[model samples]
Target: MVEYPHPVDIKVHQKSRFLDIAFDDGSHFSLPCEYLRVYSPSAETRGHSPATAKLERGKEMVSITQIEPVGQYAIKIHFDDGHNSGLYDWRYLYNLGKHHDELWQAYLDKLKAVGYQRKDPELAPPDVDV
Candidate 1:
């Protein structure tokens, strides 16, 4: 079995809308709340497979409301937008941090391809049903 580097410290910077995590392997990441929310591992977001994965939109200003530890391996992140199903495991979190740039760019590209315009949450129109 492989031993994964566990998180030694996790801090939620509410004001900045990002989570700072440090691992035992000398790795650290400052993950944006919007990024985490869009890349959530929940079935509603990731689905059962890549082909079924849903595209998350309108989350530019979303923030983390809370984070609950799931036993010894993962954490459940609660978003301010009411999404709280994803279980972010140690390895998965590490990978997200490691490949942040690429993953973020891919997400942006996907949104653009689907014709979704990202805009500031405050200036967005009220309750335009998708």
Candidate 2:
């Protein structure tokens, strides 16, 4: 069984799309929204098996639209893209926060190997016709 060390503070920096988590043990970490989005534990993201997990790209700008507490152990985060099924337990969140650098780099390498870009390239900027 996994246990989460209680956090002394959890601050969401909306502009940067990062979460600054401070633990009671005086450890702290800053995690990006893109990292959280790609690593979401929802079935839609992680799938039923590791072999079936779908690759998620174009989510570099994804942000948490809502964060709702689920009982006393987890948080339900709703993404801007309408995905809200992942239940991020405290322990899981803590682990992610602690191992963010390694996990994030691995994800980036996977994306690069697959030729996946984190931002959409098809959207055109609006222009006024003269």
- The per-model lDDT (C-alpha) reads 0.87, 0.77
Off by over 4 Å in 1: 120-130
- For every model shown, the clashing-pair count is 0, 0
Model 1 agreement with the true structure over 36-56: per-residue lDDT tens digits: 999999999999999999999
Q: Lowest lDDT 10-mer window, candidate 2? A: 121-130
TM-score of 2: 0.84
Scored against the true structure, residue 115 in model 2 reaches a CA lDDT of 85
Q: Which numbered prediction scores highest in lDDT against the true structure? A: 1
Q: Give lDDT tens digits, candidate 2, residues 28-70.
A: 8777767788899899889999998988888877777788888
